[model samples]
Target chain A: MYFGPPGNTLVIVVSPPPDRPGLPARRVTIADIARAAGVSIAVVSYAVNGRPGVSAATRERVLRIAEEYRWQPSAAARSMHTGPRAVGLVVSTAAGGVSSASSFLDLVTAIQDVFGKHGYALLLKVVESVDAAVATYRTWWAERRFDVMIVTDVLSQDPRVEALRALRAPAVVVGAPAAAQGLTSVHLDDAEAFGRVASYLIGLGHRDVAVVTGQPELHRTQVRVAALARMLKDAGGSLLRMTTDAGPEEAAAATRQLLTSPVPPSVIVYDSDQMALAALDVARRLGVEVPWDLSILAASDSALCRLSTPALTALPSPLRELGTAVGDAVLAVLNGQSATSHVVPVGGLAIRGSTGPLARRTKQ
Target chain B: MYFGPPGNTLVIVVSPPPDRPGLPARRVTIADIARAAGVSIAVVSYAVNGRPGVSAATRERVLRIAEEYRWQPSAAARSMHTGPRAVGLVVSTAAGGVSSASSFLDLVTAIQDVFGKHGYALLLKVVESVDAAVATYRTWWAERRFDVMIVTDVLSQDPRVEALRALRAPAVVVGAPAAAQGLTSVHLDDAEAFGRVASYLIGLGHRDVAVVTGQPELHRTQVRVAALARMLKDAGGSLLRMTTDAGPEEAAAATRQLLTSPVPPSVIVYDSDQMALAALDVARRLGVEVPWDLSILAASDSALCRLSTPALTALPSPLRELGTAVGDAVLAVLNGQSATSHVVPVGGLAIRGSTGPLARRTKQ
Candidate 1:
């Protein structure tokens, strides 16, 4: 019930017997296991690893003694390559805020599942900037921390990719290959999906549309925004744009500002499901009926979109599928096979109630 | 443009001139830097690290060559306690769910700010389970991956605390200390804030209330649920509890289910700002006007809570303050001080338009 003032520091001295004591019992090694089992270190190693060449009786006996002692193979002794393999993911909020994207979370979750099933654990590092992300990746590799690394939100000519590739650190990138240089893009196309949404909106007689997305510095966002704009223009329509940090509040504020503007668009598109829903909240507050008065689109779809009032029309980014591909790409790299780019199909549009014809609008 | 079929494994065959070719120009080590500078590796180390015993001229000359040839200090060469110091955070969505808690994200973000100013960077590992989290904590320690570890969402009599203590792994737990045994909790009370909200609603003459939160399995959730139930009972009112994953869709569904019930709660309390907003969205769709028809309270305050149609009344869980305490606790542990639990002050009510007297509901 006691809380600290700004400068106060408290300490609890719980004197309990330590779980691991410094009192020396002679240290046991593989050599000791070999000596005790009356076998060579090679035989002990073979038995311990379940590799062939050790007799069943000797294997069982060696395993039993190892279990009794609770011996652990030292990392240095396992020598970098032979140690337990893990996949490392270096995520950053810096270099244009990839953290704001739900796809980023979905990708990591999917990677964890696929990697976990393969007996590979994850070493996740969420750093502040791209520089810190790269530094962590380099330091982790130099330290022999994990077997392979995963990099997300790649930049055009990313230094992280260059550094990781220069180190030949087994790596998979979750972005476009054009920006990634030679590093395989463990990426799927959300661009094509945006194009489809653009055409869908144009077809519905929306002449003026706006795309609200995350940081402009991000390669994926830039690419998607440009592609969508171009497609919208080609369809005899014009697309306006807004950028945000992708937080719900930012999105909500942008929605309110845009809606109140002198020349507001009839249709609006959002980069995230959360943001699109925020737009809905803004609309409802202002008495703007969705679809009937203002059509809306969300780039990424989730259960939130489907269940929201008016059920937002959305272009599914297939984040889990992209993540699975990313996992595969990481495995492929770790397996030392040809590191090939995995182009994932962008998810199709789910035409819910949020989008409608320009003729339906009864602007107050 | 060609993405993979579900079963297809595509290959890029990029094989660009490898960034780092096997054609070795003799690898440079500390000895090479020393030889080039006409000094010992010790002198080179002193120069590189800005340690004493090396002349300024020699230090400059040694650094120039080391930079020229990119001679680096290997992890083994740096040795234990001599390498860089970093703080470790192992966040787990394991033991049911912790991801739904906005407080958890706030804590990490806060920790990052406090630690970064002190020249410490976070090495975060988000794992799938408590067992994996504990293993990661131990491994990160043994490998000297970080100087200290951070454990969140402490359980009642948590094994992670015992394991960390046994391994002498420096750590700070984010939740209360009961489950941590003696590890210390860098947490504040939300119970008080919830109590005030209950009183506020009771003052409005609300009889029926519902508490909707995520993951009843979490110890924090259990305590909050119990406390809220007790407060509601004391007000001569019964409380209904609903468990969810705290996803917007799930919350919306729960809202619909509760509203259509035989005796719907006059006031609904949501665990997250997002969920409360979702509940609002559901209300909007169901023609159930908020405050007049049903009142709402958000457990955590964020921008999303403030921007809704009828902005939610919320209990502010000052995430940054709790996070700062967590950072200080980790720092204290790393500094080799006795583990101290710092309680954070609970936040006051941010009364918005979401709540109104039950008699006011009769108007609609």
Candidate 2:
């Protein structure tokens, strides 16, 4: 496969068709080209607009017929052939919502670095919901404003996948393969990461474990929950699950509720490093000694985890590598490759001062 | 001041001039219109492209002459008139660099929310340096890819401002007015905020103070340092300044160096909450008691500051309000209005557990 040299100019050549006697009376439309090429209008559109889905031969035939018929594209369609290269990424969240996960920004930076090297700008739109994101994508697609799209936070049975499929837009999803619904995806092995967590906790002779995770609806959250639950059960241990909005206060509230419960677990695991830090604050306030009366673990690691009072034992997700993988997938899709999924490796659990043997939990 | 209704469609009308005897022998170009209108090619180009820096009357005249000559715009110029409305924001930072200040993401979200309401998309590009950022802006300007640009992290003598001015690109700087170099700016009252910090610390009976700040070249950092240093001198107290790359390790190292020095200040202030948190970790390892043996403060506030072991006292910059102000400035520039700077209100210092009266300190 040829990866063209990075540059500002984009060259798409369309040779003139066999000589015709005269120009048509009326202007040639996409419908005329579709009929002449013996293909559906969508196929003609995909070919004419330089979008993915149609084969190279089909695109060439459609273009030749379009040239022969003297078809003129609207300004919006014309811009697609002349505009600066760009990729659209619509983030569905409330204002300031993205700040909660610095990892999101890291991922964006990584992706931008890759696309920038390939001479493509990232067009970002922050909307309020998945429906709005889908609508934004539809509008951008209709305008032919960008060459490709990057879809993140893929949901179970996401509508975006189907929407992009129908539009024949080239896109890459940054989530699990199952959630991607056959689209190209770059994701971490959440199940494998969580399995390592369970083994480490079970090795500490802890039979009872509790998990504090973000929104339960997230496919990532579900995957980790399933993996940890399965592993704990296999070890003859029990698992308790609690969910938060991924905010520090919510995480603290969940931690408080767990510690005061009639039967609190021997260890508590948090989905994010920030959430785990909040739990540490809550534990300190409740006069619970870490790794002595209780244990704490963060599923995601960051500088915060390394510097916290009792440095948190965490499963480090390779966010930069994951981002690079996502960027590569985007480039592949844009280059007309078939949809493929990539699973980047996750690092081993970093054992710190946060976790200890269940025998130390005398109060429990 | 007509603030057009928010929508995707952009209409630029150029009506045909009074009947000309006959069409020109050759295609008319911007140069032909410029010659006919008795203006420089730049002026005519600006007028024809609907960009700023051209008077309304001159633009009208240029448009009429161009229509009279039957001049047609290139594909790029035509796209400027019909493409979806967008604003560009190029962040000059290394990959994963933006993750350090979650506040940056908050600002982006806030800005995106306002622009989204106005039917504009935010096109983001993250580059490695200011020079690259300016080059990106120049390319985008030539392509007419965006309606306005949002500039951030203004330096004492920024080349970006000069470049944008030369291109006559409508832009808004998110920094001090002095640093904006005649461009519209949205900024916090850094002097006022720093003055408040100075007074609060001095009122607590602290004599000597040390500040751990990010890159000193940043306009924001310079303003803060000058304000704090001047105020400290006026109050008969000495000030020590330390700079960092805004990384947690650097902040920690700075804190350790200060603590192990021959003479440590009674109080320490940090440029960011993350740095302040790192300082707390350093203080803990050094056996220095916060608010007792030493006082700590953060210039920017966040949930981490509120939830730290010894909750940090911080000056909360109204990032959301600042972002809204920036959005408004961008819209004003797009609507053919003159450039103007805006200063959003900053909240007063929030006194928390980390700071206390200097009388409580005895180690010195």
- Give the interface RMSD of candidate 1: 5.2
DockQ, candidate no. 2: 0.14
C-alpha lDDT of candidate 1 relative to the true structure = 0.71
- Please give the TM-score that candidate 2 achieves against the real structure: 0.78
Candidate 1 lDDT, B152-192, residue by residue in tens: 76665667788777766667877766656677567767556
Highest lDDT among the candidates is held by which one?
A: 2
DockQ for all models, in order? 0.22, 0.14
In candidate 2, which residue pairs clash? none
Candidate 1 CAPRI classification by DockQ: incorrect
Best by TM-score: 1
Off by over 4 Å in 2: A1-84, A94-100, A361-364, B1-80, B94-100, B361-364
- Tens-digit lDDT track for model 1 on A1-364? 1121222122222222454332113334566655555566787678778988766766777687565544555444443335335677666767544434334545667776676666555665556788887787766655555677887777766788887766666778888887776766777686787778778888888878888888776778887888888988787878788888877788888888888888778998998887888899898888778988799888878777887778989887677788888888877777778667778988779999999888645554
Model 1: pairs clashing at backbone N, Cα or C within 3 Å: B155-B179, B156-B179, B157-B179
